[model samples]
Target chain A: MKLLKEKVMAEGIVLGEQVLKVDSFLNHQMDPMLMKEVGSEFVRRFAGEGITKVLTIESSGIAPAIMTALELGVPMIFARKNKSLTLKEDIYVESVYSFTKRETNEITVSKKFLNADDRVLIIDDFLANGEAAFGLARIVEQVGASVVGIGIVIEKSFQPGSKLLKEAGYRVDSLVRIASLENGTVTFVEGE
Target chain B: MKLLKEKVMAEGIVLGEQVLKVDSFLNHQMDPMLMKEVGSEFVRRFAGEGITKVLTIESSGIAPAIMTALELGVPMIFARKNKSLTLKEDIYVESVYSFTKRETNEITVSKKFLNADDRVLIIDDFLANGEAAFGLARIVEQVGASVVGIGIVIEKSFQPGSKLLKEAGYRVDSLVRIASLENGTVTFVEGE
Candidate 1:
């Protein structure tokens, strides 16, 4: 967590009191060693809940989620943003609106992957409005599967995502919490 | 390679004569251990190339690319299919046509991550028409970076991708080469 926070503070770019551009190391260009550590941390946090699958959105979340799934010895499932030609039928669907892109896209997972017997751990790169997280959790519930917990790499505490998930009774664990991104600077939430 | 061939014969679904759906382990829902082994195999094949970075497209390519990057002790960068809000400028762009999705996506990589001094290893989940790999290689060439080799998880030898890439003088290493997908059966090209 300390390593993630340091990398964020050193490389994260803040824009207009929102939008942290971590393309240098976190999202677009990734540090594999750091991601491996992040994965180990997630496994350490959610060790004994009997997680059957590690679920995440495509693109950014795949790196961390796959690493966590590797360490935990479980499979990783990434919900597709668009319906592809192969993944066309018998799928659980959820609509998520991205505040960053300002567009709505339907995310889906094959029904063959998730079921009542699975325990899911949701992981993502960033948590702002919690829309993506909620959408993934909804898909997990649609298959009668239970969400064991949610693991986030970075959370904007100034936003309502962390608070919202906690209020809904989900155990949310974020590696770094941003208190503010005002005046072209980042502030971290210290001491819990 | 034998393990990968066995997985393909066991879980890969041949849709018609052209499509092979590997959503179970290679793509959508991923087995982390298998992917780890895949990374090791790729590392073994492309070793001593002095690959400074690993490059791949987003979604399916991220899993194997990250693991390869982890073992090679380098960074991994995924080209974004769509231009997000944060990734708007100073990028190397290439248009890739997805034969599976029947769509053309403009993939972009930040200029900050790649440059002339870098040696890149391109990795992908599947190699069919070679559009995505070509696009990635073009992006690398745009920045004056050299592509050491291309690593593919599955190569549909019936398709023209492998031939095109090899003719272009690129080192192509495929874990499993499929000879045919006829009559609802998966066939592998044995012994080169």
Candidate 2:
């Protein structure tokens, strides 16, 4: 977490006190070495929770989720943002609104991948309004699986997402948390 | 490669003569164990190519590209389909036509990720008409980076993608090459 915090402070771009763009390292252009460490940290935090699968939404979440799944020796299931031609029609779908893009898109996971017997860990790149995380959690609930925990790479603590998940009684862990992004600078949550 | 071939034969769904869906393992619901093997195989194939970076498009390609980047100890960059607000406007963009989706999406990679000195190894989940791969190659070329090779998980050899890459003198490697998908059954190329 310290390494991630340092990386964020060094490479993260704060835009207008709301968006923390980590495209240089965490999201768009990824540093797999750092990601592998992040995956290891997630495994360290949630390995004993009987996680049979790692679940994340597509695109950004796939990398860290894949790395975590690799570390945990479990399969990973990513909810698709848009229904692809190859994805089966019979899927557990949930609608998620992106505050950034200001559009609602349905996230889906195949019913074939998740089941009642599985215990899942939800992972994602960023946690802002928590719409994506809750949408993924809904899909897990629909499949009758248990969500062991949620792993996040970057959490905008100034926002409501992580707090919302905690209030829902879900254990959420973020590698790098931004406490405040006031005046074009980022402040990390002290001692977290 | 044998493991990948077996996975495709067992879990891959042949939607029609043209479409083979391996989302159950390779893309959507991923088997990280098998994918780790796939990554190792890619490293085995392209390890000596001096690849400074692993390049792929967003969504499906991120997993394998992540694994390969981990194996190679290099960074991976994914081209974004939608221009993210976080992404810089000065980007290397290319228009890619998806035969399956029947639409053109412009993929952009941040100008910060690639440079003239970089040697990129392009990786993707599927190679059909080679539009995505070519589009990625164009981005690499735009940055003045050399594309060392292109590694594909599944190649629909019946399509023109692989042939197009080969004709262009790009080193093309596919784990499983479908000779034909006739009668709704996959027929792999005889030896490789």
Candidate 3:
């Protein structure tokens, strides 16, 4: 978390008090070493939860989720943003609206991968309005599987995502919590 | 490679003469332990290439590419399939036609991530028509970065992807090469 916070402070670009661009090492360009450590930290936090699978949305979430799944010795499943040609049916689908892109895209996970007996850990790169997290949780619920916890790399605490997930009774563990990104500077939540 | 071949033989579903569904391990539903081995294998194959970066397209390619980057101690970059609000301008864009989906997508990578000094290794989940691989290569070339080699998890050797890449004079290292998928059977290229 310290390393992630430091990386954010060093390289994260704040745009107009809302967007944090971590393209240098988090999303667009990834730091695998950092991802490994983030995975280990997620494992350390959710070790005793009996997680059978690690679930995440595609693209950015794949790196951290795959690393966590590797550490925990479980399979990682990424929910596709769009329906693919091969993945035709028997899937749990949820509609998520991205505040950044201002568009709603349906995220899907094949029913073949998740089941009622499985315990899942949801991981993602960033948590803002919690649409993506809730959408993932809905897919998990549709399959009757239990969401043990949610692991986030960067949580915009100024936003409603972290609070909403906690209110919904899901354990949300974020590596770094951003208190504010105002005036072209980042502020981390103290003692988190 | 032996282990990968075994996995393909065990879990890979032959959809037809053309499609090989490796969703259980390689792409959709990922095995982290297997991916770790895959990353290490890629590193072993392209060890001395001085690869400064690992590049791939979004969604399917992130896992293997990130793992390779982890092993190589470099950064991994996944080209976006569509334009996003955050990543707007100053990007290297290439149009890739997905034969499976029957559509063309414009993939973009920020110019800030890649440059002329980079030695890149392109990694992907599958190699069929080579559209995705060539698209990524063009982006690399746009920045004047040299593509040292391409690492593929599964190569449909019966298709033109391997031949086309080889013809283009790029080193193609595939973990498992499939000879054919005729009559609902998966056959591997002998001695590969």
Candidate 4:
């Protein structure tokens, strides 16, 4: 977590009061070595939870989720953002709003992947509005699966996502939590 | 490779004449152990290639690419399928047509991650039309980076992707090459 916070402080760019871009290492162009550490740390945090599957959204979340799945020795299922011809009609669907894209899109997972027996662990690159994690939990619930925990690489603690998910009865853990991003400077939450 | 082929044979669903969905292990829901084997196999095949970076498209390609990057001790960068607020104005962009989705999407990568000195190895889940590889190669070329080779999980040799890439003078390797998918029976190319 210290390594992540250090890398974030060194490379993270704040465009506005809301936008934090860590694409140089975290999301678009990934540092797999750092990601491996992040995965191991998540495993340590959520160990003994009987996590049967790791769930995430497509694109950005796939890398960290895959790494965590590797460490946990479980399959990682990412909900696809678009409806493709290859995807079957029988699927659990949820709509999520993206503040960056300023649009709402449907994300889905095939019913074959999730079921009542699955103890799902949700992972994502960032948790701000908490919509993506909530949407993933909704899909898991549709299959009668239990969400064991949620792991995030970075969390904007100033945002309401953490509180919202915690109030919804989900245990959420973030490696680096930004306390504030005022005037293009990032402030980390102490003791995170 | 045997493990991958066995997974494909057991869990792969043949939808039509050309569609083989191995979402159970290879894509949608990924078996991390098998993917670890895949990453090691790719490292064995491309050993001593001096690959500075592993490149791929988003969603499905990120998992294997991340694993491969982990094995190779290099960073992995996935091209975003759409423009986002986090991305900068300076980028390498290319248009790729998805046969399954029946649409062309613009993929972009930040100019900061790739450079002329970088030797990139492209990785992907499926190589059918080879459009994604070609598109990724175009982005690398835009940044003046050399594409050392291309690694694919499953190649539909029945299609023109492999042949086209080979003819284009890019070294392309697939773990499993399917010769035919006649009547829902998947046939592998002998000795591949």
Q: Per-residue lDDT tens digits of candidate 2, residues A1-192? A: 888888988998888889988887778889998988999999998867989999999789988898899899999999999988877588999999999988999998988889898999999999999999999998999988999999999999999999999999899999888899998999988887
Give the Å shift of residue A45 in candidate 3.
Answer: 0.8
Question: Between candidates 2 and 3, which one is better according to lDDT?
Answer: 3
Model 3, residue A89: C-alpha shift (Å): 1.0
Q: Relative to the true structure, how large is the alpha-carbon lDDT of every model?
A: 0.94, 0.91, 0.94, 0.91
**TM score of chain A per candidate:** 0.98, 0.98, 0.99, 0.98
How many clashing pairs does model 4 include?
0
Candidates sorted by DockQ, descending order?
1, 3, 4, 2
Cα lDDT tens digits, model 4, A1-192, are: 999988998999998888899988888999989988998999999999999999999888888888899999889998998877888598899999988789898998999889899999999999999999999999999999999999999999999999999999999999999999998999989876
Model number with the top DockQ? 1
Q: Give the TM-score of candidate 3.
A: 0.98
Candidate 1 wrong stretches, greater than 4 Å: none
Candidate 3, residues B93-187, lDDT tens digits: the string is 99999999999999999999998999999999999999999999999998988999999999999999989999999999999999999999998
| Residues B87-118, model 2: lDDT tens digits | 75889889999998888999999898899999
Displacement of the residue A114 alpha carbon in candidate 2, Å: 0.9
Q: Estimate each model's TM-score.
A: 0.99, 0.98, 0.98, 0.98
